[model samples]
Structure formats: structure tokens, C-alpha cells
Target chain A: MKEIALHMLDIAENSLDAGATKVELLLELTTGGMLEFSILDNGKGMDDETLKMTSDPFFTSRTTRRVGMGIPLLRQHAELAGGGLKTRSEKGKGTELKAVFVAGHPDIQPLGDIEGCWMMLAAMHNDVNIELRCSTPKGDFEISSELARQELEVEHLNESALRTELKRLIRNNLAAIGFTDGKIDKTILNS
Target chain B: MEKIRSLADLKKIRDENNKGVELRKKGEDADKLVQVKVAMATCGIASGAKETMEFLADSLEKRGVEAVVTQTGCMGYCYAEPTIEVTLPGRDPIVFGNVNVKKADEIIEKYIKGGELVDGIIPVNYETIDSKE
Candidate 1:
């Protein structure tokens, strides 16, 4: 994925496929130029053997194809961006993945279109509850499917007007939190 | 993680749980149910296909419409990203382009519900594999 948000999307998909009922994603950008992205899911987690081999691109539990590239690709991106990937999983419990990167690193990819990510994921997996929280120098922005559903009085996140409202809410909140330029600092790379 | 070796076994389990909700059935004709295919390729995602798909799913269910919504790869219509192909029972599938939430609502209300075609129909330039034979 060319964008960090796309990577987050792929990881979220994996969580959903695992029968996750709730998933929480946290994106934090510190003033020191460190970007931390984490996803925690309550789903059927991997066994010790599978968890150990998750970083391998060639290993996959799916019978459809031979390779599962989500985690491996994320690991590659993190390493290229002067960071690392960490994962913890326990059988029948859940999984948590965290990737850290330097915002000013030349190899760090752009965040890309995150509004699309939230809209798509929330819309598609209405059965799964998602809580997205991001922290930056400005403040913290948080959104959750459960809350959105309750506020809108809608049974599902895929409702047309509700999705629109959610999109608007996320965009406004992100803009308020210094993401108006699409990144923490546009001059970070130039510096 | 345990490997899913037998797709048939998985289907059996799913079928056991999704008695009436299952949209597609073995040996069933396409005319038996409303079928919707949303483009979900990279371009489509970038162009808000995800939002369009969500609207279709939510509205259909809320209105008590029985439809099987699925995703498909690019249909060589990058210019018309976020496109959808809706096939009402016993009718040829119609492809609509540039579908947003509003367009999706119109589709659900005017076209899918009332059987009246609306705007944004991308003329069918090619035939699908299923339509060929």
C-alpha cells in the first residue's frame, strides 16, 4: 500500500475476517516527529505457531493462495520508515498490531485518504464495531461506530445519511486537529 | 490459525446459519433475486465506492428489499470509478457510474424500488462472462 491509511485498511480487514466484534485503531503523532499506528481487535486470535510466523510473507493460513502479504508488507514499510512493527496475539483472545515510524523519514509514505478508509470499513462491516482515536500535538480526535449508531438512531453504520454525517464529522475533527494539510507537518520532509 | 481446507465445508456451515439471508443458492437462476455488484478496485475505493456500497446495503435492508450485494474488481471504467451493476430479477444488468450516497438513494428509490431507470447509466460497452453464454 502506498499510503499508511491503506495499510491500516488491510489490517482491519484481517481483523474482520477473524470474526472480530470490536476493533480499535489508534494513530498518534507526537511533537517529536514519531508516528504510532496501532490496531487492537477482539477476535479469534492466532495460535503461538501462527503468531510467530505472521511476519513471514510466504506463510498464510488460507487455503486459497500461498502467501499472506499484509503484515509482511507493513513490516517492510515500517522498517523503511525508520521504525518497526510489533504484534501480540493469543488463541481465542484477540490480536494487537502496532507500527511506529518517524514522520520526517524520507521513506515514510503519506497518510493518504483516511476518510475513505473509515467510510468503507464502517459501511461494509456493520456487524463489527470500530473505535478510531488519534492524538496529535493539537489534541485528540475520536470516533466510534457504536456511538455514531446510537446518536443517529440507526441500526447500522451503512445508512446513507448517517454515513455522510460520519464522514463530515471525521473530516471536520481531523481538520481541527491540524490535519488540514493532510499530515502533521508538511515541512517535515523538507526539513 | 487453522487452515480453511474445504470451501464446501465452510459453505455448508454458512448455509446452516444463513437460511433466508443467503442471496445465492446452488442451481438457482439469476432472475430469482435482486443482484448488486459494486466496483471495489483501488480506483473505486479512492472514488467512494465503499460509501456507495454501504448505502446500498443499509437502504436495501431497511426497506425490506431482498438483495445480494457483492463486490467486484475494476470493469475497465477508472474514469467512472464507484460504479455499480444492478440486476433486477429477469432483467439485464444496468451499470451506473459515479455513484455516491445520493445517487445510491435514487437507485434504491427510483430504479430498484420503482423499476424506473434513472440517470448515470454508463452504456454497456462490453458483456460480462455470465452474460456471454
Candidate 2:
């Protein structure tokens, strides 16, 4: 939870565990002086009971354990930065989680290793259709795992060479959008 | 590697490169092949589970083994930050704890390949609500 990117990976994993075939990770680099992001999936959504306890660190749906801190931790991360988190889910529908972080807040965590997060998400799950969309004042750049697979003609995106290539591609594209090195550049605010 | 500004650019380089690696045949439950579920809760991530996961996925593919590597929530093994459950075709799942990249490699070579049980097996004797009769 130290890095916001790790939080993204955690939530994406939750979507996969929920049997989500389509996972979308959206990032708005700087909005109203805040960093906003969301992970949406068409997986098995939570019921009212489960949704109510989502922010409770001890309330977990997993039978193997009793504690689940993913959501709680993300909420805390957002709050620490003078932002907040929102969750909306319906039974048998899907889950949508949005988190915000104040851009200038001193306690804001760095957006660590987003490239690794995206790379792992795309590489690890070849069957799942994952997409990454980063929106900044400059413009929006999107990376669809399906599109990438189609372009590369690679069945499984787990190829090490391709992983490196995709990671580089993500880094470069994100950089072009003024989000680089796990933190947004100052130019983004002016633009 | 040239600059990959877009997917098109990426495709241009590997234009002729197509083939190699098979996840599973069409219409077959890929889980019937090899299923790896990695614990990826906060504790797991703090303990470098991400690295282990990437290693497992990469090595499994590189070895030509058709496996589906997925991430699961906490398995109540906070002490063992990085834990993984491996299920072979038609076999019960086995949970391994304190798994680093090296242990992951060993598990891949001996357990997954040789069908021999590896060390660090965390005995699973409890039942989940889904399993309760």
C-alpha cells in the first residue's frame, strides 16, 4: 500500500479472483489538483452485506482467512493524502472502486512501479482482457492487452522479451502523458 | 528494441514472429492443465509476492508448461507473506508458504515437473463456508 500502483495491482487481483474476464484500470493523472484512479471489472460483485463491510479490515469474504485489508488500506491511503475512496458494487453485477489522492499533499504516496504493475497484469493473465488508460491534461493514451496481443500475434503475453517490450512501451506512453517515474511532472498542472 | 510508441509500432518489429507457446487447446478448461493461485493481499505484496508471481508466470511459460497463474486473496498466512497454492490436473491443491523466487523455481522443477511434493507445505485441514454442508 506504500505505492498507489501496488493498490491498483491488489484491486485488479481482486477482480480476477472474482472471475472477472474484463478488467479496466483507469488513471486521471491530475484532476482538480488530485490524482484519481479507478479499477472496474465485470466480475461477481458483492452483495449489500459484503459491500457494507468492504472498508472493514477484518471483514473478508475469503474462507481461507478472516482479514482483508485491501479496501481499507486503499481508503486509508487516500484519506492520508486528503482524498477519499468510493466503492460501488451490486450482486452478480460487478465492482467499481475509485480512489483519489491530493496531488500536493505531503503525505501522498508515490505512484510506484506502474510499469511493473501493468506488465504483470497483462503478462500473468493471458485469457483476461485488461486495458490501461491514462488520462492527463495533454491527452489520453490507452493500452489494450487484446490489441497488443493482436498486434504482436502472441497467444500468451507471458513472453519475457515481450514483457520487457510492453513494459518499455507502457513507460514511454505514460511518460508522454506527463506521468513518469512514479510521479506526475509539474508541467501537468500547468497544462 | 526500437521505440514502441504504439501497438502498431510493436507489431512492426515482430511482424514475422508468430507461434511458440500453447496455453491450452480450444474449448478446454485451462485449469485442467496447471493452476497456480498466488496469495496477493497486502502482506503478500509486502513480502515480494509480486516478484514470485512474475517469476512463476515467466518460468512456467519459458519451460513450455501450459499453466494458468492467478492471484488470490489472503489465505490466512500473514506470517508467510508470499504463499502459493498449486493444483495439478485431477489433484488436490497444495499450499506452499514463505516462497521466494528460488523456492518457486524449486517447486516448478521438482513438484510441478517431477510430481514430487516439495518442502514448506502448509497443511490445509480447515473447511470454508462454501464447503460446509
Q: Which candidate achieves the best DockQ against the true structure?
A: 2
Q: Fill in the DockQ of model 2.
A: 0.28
lDDT of each: 0.74, 0.82
Interface RMSD of each: 15.9, 5.2
lDDT of 2 by residue, B1-133 (tens): 1232576767754653444433333216865688999988778987889889989988997897878787877777778769999999989999999999999999999999989998999888755444564
Tens digit of per-residue lDDT, candidate 2, span A56-117: 99887677666788889899989999999999998788999999988778898888778889
Model 1, position A172: C-alpha lDDT score: 64
lDDT of 1 by residue, B76-119 (tens): 56678789999998899999999999999999999998999999
Q: How close is candidate 2 to the true structure, as a TM-score?
A: 0.79
Q: What is the alpha-carbon lDDT of model 1 when measured against the actual structure?
A: 0.74
- For each candidate, report what fraction of the true interface contacts it reproduces: 0.03, 0.33
lDDT of 1 at A39: 95
The residue pairs found clashing in candidate 2 are: none
TM-score of each: 0.65, 0.79
Stretches off by above 4 angstroms in model 2 are A47-49, A186-191, B1-5, B19-36, B60-70, B86-94, B102-119, B123-133
Could you tell me how far off, in angstroms, the CA of residue B19 lies in candidate 1 after the best superposition?
36
Q: What is the C-alpha RMSD of each candidate to the true structure, in Å?
A: 11.8, 4.3
In terms of docking quality, how is candidate 1 classified? incorrect
Q: How many residue pairs clash in each candidate?
A: 0, 0
